[model samples]
Target: MKKFTVLELLSLELKEHNDLDLKCIAGRKGLARKIEVPNVNRPGLALSGFFESFAYNRIQIFGRGEHAYLKKLEKEKKSENIKKIFTFDIPCAIFTHNLMPTKDFLDAAEEAGCAVLQTSLPSANFTARILRVLNDIFAAREVVHGVLIEVFGIGVLLTGESGVGKSETALELIERGHRLVADDAVEIRCVGGNYLMGMGANKMLGHHMEIRGLGIINITHLFGVGSIRDEKRIELVVNLEIWDSNKQYDRLGAQKKTKEILGVRLPCVDIPIKPGRNIPILIETAAMNERLKQLGVHSSREFNEQVMRWLESENVRNIYFHNNSI
Candidate 1:
């Protein structure tokens, strides 16, 4: 990730609930200051001259309480502490609920080259939205050549070599009512160190797909808004390859295979492409099976267990019959 500055945060084209509604109030010179962490700190303690463990690196948040305290400090002519607060290299100061800072506080921030931002949202709401945005910006990401789609509510990443029919299969699935998350280049990110989130590498070209002879086609325009999604959690990975007559494939699905992306392991399946094979339906079935597994209903394991029980019963019946005949 490149340097994320206060200017970039202000320029983010967030919508609705995710909007920060932020604008520069003072210290415009420090808009290029890099934001190093995904966390924010309220400078209440630091403002009161308690500098023991001041987190000067994070973005400082000024809520109602903090704003009132600054007014009190200014009324008492105690501007020394206000100036001291900006001595450190703080990323920026954000005033929530459209609160304005005292003249002394703004002068101090401007003098020290620390950016001051104001938002119309309440402190709690702004905090939540900014945290969500920062987490995404700071997450570990990688770009892979594949197509991502949602089948039966499961997010599946279709991967393989070039021209192995990944995009074509996704097209078929989209035609069959599945939603396309991204086509061609999928940018996958590890969020919360637990799950993987995948989206289009470029937001401008997100829902566009390039078929062999069809060239570039917009999935949203052709299939409507219902057929496209901006992002999805990658729950399963399906690798499609040319049919190998000599290579063995998993016949029973008793052994589960996995693929690791950014330290997160996801369930993976290998599908060999050949004539007369319905790749789209196979992918749909795989997605459904994955959902069933998540519900603790593993089909392959249950089948193997039932087979073992039947063999044990047959052996016991044979032994009893032989003993009785003797």
Candidate 2:
């Protein structure tokens, strides 16, 4: 994984919860410093001159309480505590609620070559937002050639060799009211807890699909906002392959298949594509069947049980009839 520098983080043009609203106040030279940890440090304990277990590697955040303490330390000429914190190689310091640090504090930060940043948001809000952003940046990601869609509230990813009609199938699904998430390329991220989330790889062409003959078409523009989604949790994966006359396909569906992505297991099904096969409807049914499985209702298992009962009943009737006839 490449290192994420403070400069890249500061340059992100995010909005709302992902927005840091950060502006560099001082210590520009420390902008190139690498942010090793995703978690942050409040330093409220360190502000009172308690230096034990100081989280210097984590980004330092100064909220209302810390700001007031800095003022008190300045009035008492206790710059020693402030200087003591700068002794460690801290990544950067952020002041929330647009609060300005005292001259002594800034001087210490400047002398130590630590970056100082300011945001208009309050401490709590900025902390939560920044944590969310950092978690995403540090998340494990992979790119796969496929099309992701939301079918009946379930995220289904369709993958196969190039020109296997993956995009066309997704387009048909969209026409049937399903939502397209990503076409052509999908970026999957593992965000802890064995969860796999997927989204479009290209930001500009996320909702657009490139049909073999029709060029690129925007699904959102043609099908309205409901026809596309920003991202979805991949629940199922369907691999479409060319139909083979000699190869045998699973008919009972008793054997469950799974696809592993980023250490997360996803239900997988293989559908062979041939002439005159309704692939889109098959995918829709697959999605609905998966939803049933999630609810602890397995159609394949139930069918197998029913068949076993019938066979046992038939064998008992045949034995009794044969003995009576003899």
Taken over the whole model, the C-alpha lDDT of each candidate is 0.94, 0.93
Tens-digit lDDT track of model 2 for 77-193: 999889999988888999999999999999998888889999999888898899888888889899999999999999999999999999999999999999999998999998864
TM-score of each: 0.97, 0.90
Residue-by-residue lDDT tens digits, candidate 1, 22-51? 999899999999998999999999888998
* Predicted structure with the largest TM-score when compared to the true one: 1
* CA RMSD, predictions in order: 1.3, 2.4
Off by over 4 Å in 2: 309-326
What residue runs in model 1 are displaced by over 4 Å at the alpha carbon?
none
TM-score of 1: 0.97
Query: Which pairs of residues have clashing backbones in candidate 1?
Result: none
